[model samples]
Target: MKNRAILIILSLLLFIIVTPSQAQTYQTGSYQTGVGIRMGNTGGISVKHFMDGRHAVEGILSARWGGIGVTGLMEWHKEAFRTEGLNFYYGFGGHLYLGRYQRYRRNYYYESRGAIGIDGILGLEYHLPRAPITGSLDWKPAINLIGRTGYHEGGLALTVRYTF
Candidate 1:
């Protein structure tokens, strides 16, 4: 458990340090809606819909702490490092974490717990220009404000979707 957390933290740091910030390239989202799956510490069903070329809203429903968590985010997307089909995005949102069991493990406890929190997302996405597919790798962090209060360094996630 500790190893996984360490690895995740290191990976995030590496990406942040390495991503080039030169005036490279970017493209507006070509697809309007993408529905897919997310795999990570909070893996679940994911859906993203673009309101325009650069703005999008994403929703995630996942199982966490023996309960359910729903997250909604509003994001802005831009081209990344002159790479075609590659985009960099960042966003913020809120989440609801609901648990209904006495779960105690690894310095964590959630007994019928429900909390509200805010979240931030950072990542890169690649859309296939010739296919209706898209993939993204992102890091999400959250802080609970209502129930379980803490700064959660959200895990790294890979999301794949069918775009339309």
Candidate 2:
């Protein structure tokens, strides 16, 4: 019917008009690389590599409770507020933890079991105009899939990483 056709056309026009036209500005090239320590009892260094205007990958290496681990993350970001220099991102990643520990009192010990898990991250980042400095605060929650050990196995961490 003509009424149905008109409704569909109106909806498409509204969608196009309401959508924001903007792109995220990213620091690229070798000079844009950054290295900084993230805060928390489990401290780590974060490295970010921008693949394009809207995508990036990061790697983290940290030590906690005498264990060392590595994590890799991929994120998709969107420019918010249009040049307000703020970016919001969501990502999923995984990690590996390894170390050594004692098992029992009967002269028994074993290499600490390595752990693997998936994590979700939500964060906001700010970039200063004309400067190579960037800062971010993120909440990351991870679920242990391999070694189910303690209460601390699943929790949230607030992290800040400096980007060049």
Candidate 3:
């Protein structure tokens, strides 16, 4: 199942990479919103909405360990190099997570009922020209302030969004 899932994700990435078109994207100030899937250690559905040319907010909803996680973010976008449809973004946000079992790398485990954390995100995004689609690779590191207090770093993800 895991291999099949990875294959599907890779195929989607290839599809996004091959097709290019012209469109006003997030950095160009003409795009309004994007909604898609977030694939990562903690992932589900993701939605991003631009407030202006460079500022945007994103929300993610995911289920894990018999519970749910909700995250919100405020981000800034800037053109990367002279590449059309390519941009770099960074942001900070917060999350509320609920779980039944949490693992530790040191060979221990515990049950975590809930927690709140601050999250930071850095990513590169590409808007497919002529297609209402965009793809991004990101790292979102987070530190829990309430429950299961610690830092998490393996938050790398690939997001494919359909924009309007």
Residue-pair clashes per candidate, as listed?
A: 2, 0, 4
Q: Give the TM-score of candidate 2.
A: 0.67
In model 1, the runs with Cα more than 4 Å from the true position are: 1-26, 101-112
Instruction: Itemize residue pairs with steric clashes in candidate 1.
Output: 25-82, 26-79
Alpha-carbon shift of residue 82 in model 2 (angstroms): 3.0
Which candidate would rank higher by lDDT, 1 or 3?
A: 1
Name the 10 consecutive residues with the lowest summed lDDT in model 1.
20-29
- Give one digit per residue, the lDDT tens place, for model 1 in 21-93: 4433444557989999999986899999988777899999999767899999998787887777898888779
Taken over the whole model, the C-alpha lDDT of each candidate is 0.83, 0.64, 0.80
Model 2, span 1-164: residue lDDT tens: 54564355456446544666455344332234556667653458888777777678878899865778888888766765554567776676888888654456468655456778765566777776666676777766565577743223233344554565
Of the candidates numbered 1 and 2, which has the greater TM-score value?
1
Lowest-scoring 10 consecutive residues by lDDT in candidate 2?
148-157
Off by over 4 Å in 2: 1-32, 100-112, 149-164
Q: Sort every candidate by TM-score, greatest first.
A: 1, 3, 2
Residues 135-158 of candidate 3: C-alpha lDDT, one tens digit per residue:
999988777889877777646899
Identify the superior model by lDDT, candidate 1 or candidate 2.
Answer: 1
How far residue 21's Cα lies from its native spot in candidate 2, in Å, is 8.9
Better of 2 and 3 by TM-score: 3
